[model samples]
Target: MCAQGTYITCANSPGQNFTGCACGQCAPPGCDGCVVHLAGGSTLRG
Candidate 1:
């Protein structure tokens, strides 16, 4: 797993990156974080 506060490069799109553990989710360009819905019905930063 990626450590918290680490920089993750977005795979779905080029030239995009985010701060924090994304769990493999891609963040949009220029976004520091992205919102993701969990299977348990909770929202968190991905």
Candidate 2:
């Protein structure tokens, strides 16, 4: 998480799960296909 608006925020995401967009599997519409793949599970395509 070092891109412009896409920065890492532990405060925002307390769970810190790799399932969220912060890690991988981006949301639909405005944001998609941006993954980090910290561990398990691959990325999801929009």
Candidate 3:
């Protein structure tokens, strides 16, 4: 899914080709999308 209302899960989307479907909970081997954009300090990968 990618028509603005983004979505891209399905097992981390071909090994981290991100888009927008990172369903529900976050932990235990589950993550493909998170905080981004940096100018001074901003980062969270998982």
Candidate 4:
């Protein structure tokens, strides 16, 4: 699971797993969606 204030995207395909903590405000290429942990204590799906 991703830690608070972070996001993650993964797949069965090779090299698709990525963590947003390593790239703030940037989503991995080909990523269709992600779960973002907000500072307001809520999760947003995009």
TM-score, per-candidate, Cα-based: 0.30, 0.19, 0.18, 0.36
The per-residue C-alpha lDDT of model 3 at residue 30 equals: 55
Flag regions of model 1 displaced more than 4 Å: 1-5, 22-46
Per-residue lDDT of candidate 4, residues 1-46 (tens digit): 3465565543423445455643335557655555554545665665
Error of 2 at 27 (Å): 5.4
RMSD of each: 8.1, 11.1, 7.7, 6.0
> Which residue pairs show backbone clashes in model 2?
none
Model 2 CA deviation exceeding 4 Å by range: 1-10, 18-37, 40-46
Global CA lDDT computed for model 2: 0.35
Model 3, residue 13: C-alpha shift (Å): 7.4
By how many angstroms RMSD does model 4 differ from the true structure? Answer: 6.0
| Candidate 2 weakest ten by summed lDDT | 2-11
Model 3 per-residue lDDT tens digits across residues 2-45: 23434333334444434433334422245545432233443334
> What global local distance difference test value does model 1 have?
0.49
Clashing pairs for model 1 are: 22-46
lDDT of 2 by residue, 1-46 (tens): 3333332223334444333435333432333234343334443232
Quick one: best TM-score, which candidate? Answer: 4
- Residue-wise lDDT of candidate 1 within 1-46, one digit each (tens)? 5443455543454565455445445554554435543445455655
Two-way TM-score contest, 3 vs 4, winner: 4
Q: Which candidate achieves the best lDDT against the true structure?
A: 4
